[model samples]
Target: MLTVILYHVIFVIVVYTDTGPPYNAFPQKLNFYYFSLYVIPSTTCFFIVLLSTIFLVVKVRRNQRWRKGTSTQTAKTNDKEDKLVRTIIAISTIFIICSFPTVSIFITQIIHKQFRYRDPYLGTLLLLMFNIGGVFQAISSSVNIFFYYRMSSRFKKVFASLFACRRSGIQGTKPSD
Candidate 1:
């Protein structure tokens, strides 16, 4: 319920927020693709992940304190929940770290009323930073697969079995075998 309301608020903000004119990619002309696809989605994911992690961590800790006298099963359940929270934290941290540069650029553009790309060197630097940020975003996404494999035995087993089946299917079907 809270999440739905939060998303609606975010949607309103995303629809109303205007991009600044400083950056070459995102001008004040208001491109729908930029707002709808890139900006809104990026901002929404960042906020949702961040807020969810904070709320979930708080709830989990509160529950732990309240259930201090519970049995071992409750303790195990708390341990599992703690692990899940940690994973969420790790993922959100990586996402924020990767997307920091891009967000910074956007913020800078918003703050500066005039275009900041008059100097060629500054423009080049911003372009490079944007590209580096994109690379980092890709790395962050790819690393989540490794995290899943590391943290979840089920995921690891399924991934391994899928690959093993492919390998066997390729090697086991030789006519000379």
Candidate 2:
């Protein structure tokens, strides 16, 4: 986590220095740096999450098979595990769907230098795509709460309590001694 924070800090510093005042346009020279820092790390993290989820699902299935004739307690535990695995898969799928546009833009930019926000013809389209991607990214970051609330009873209770109205006392008065 520290390394990830440090890596992003370095990226911010580099981009800030490269862009100078106003920072209207990114330095084309740093395209490779952007690709290496942002694209590669994000892609790697996505794949890692995907692969780990797959392994977890396989392990859970294997356990379920072995515990087929186990006690009711084990069955309940397996049901919880199944919900968790499903939640993870849903989250991973959302992440991939949301990130696709941004990743596609990055790779496209790298392959065709002419394809960017400055192009006279494609500039508007590219900007729109970028904005849509940003919206999707925001959704990806926030939508996990809904999944947890839906899939996990404990999460649902805790989440509800966070917003649940409470009556401290009648008419805002303190309780009688």
Q: Judging by lDDT against the true structure, name the best candidate.
A: 2
In candidate 2 the C-alpha lDDT for residue 82 amounts to 81
Candidate 1 Cα RMSD (Å): 6.6
For candidate 1, give the lDDT: 0.71
- TM-score result, candidate 2: 0.76
Q: Considering summed lDDT, which 10 consecutive residues are worst modelled in model 2?
A: 162-171
lDDT of 1 by residue, 34-78 (tens): 445455656667677778878888988887776775644465777
Candidate 1, superposed: residue stretches over 4 Å from native: 1-37, 70-75, 115-121, 175-177
Clashing pairs in 2: none
User: Candidate 2 lDDT, tens digit per residue, 73-158?
Assistant: 46578778788879988998898889888888877877888886678988898899989999999999999888888998988888
For model 1, give the 10-residue run with minimal summed lDDT: 20-29
TM-score of each model, paired residue for residue: 0.71, 0.76
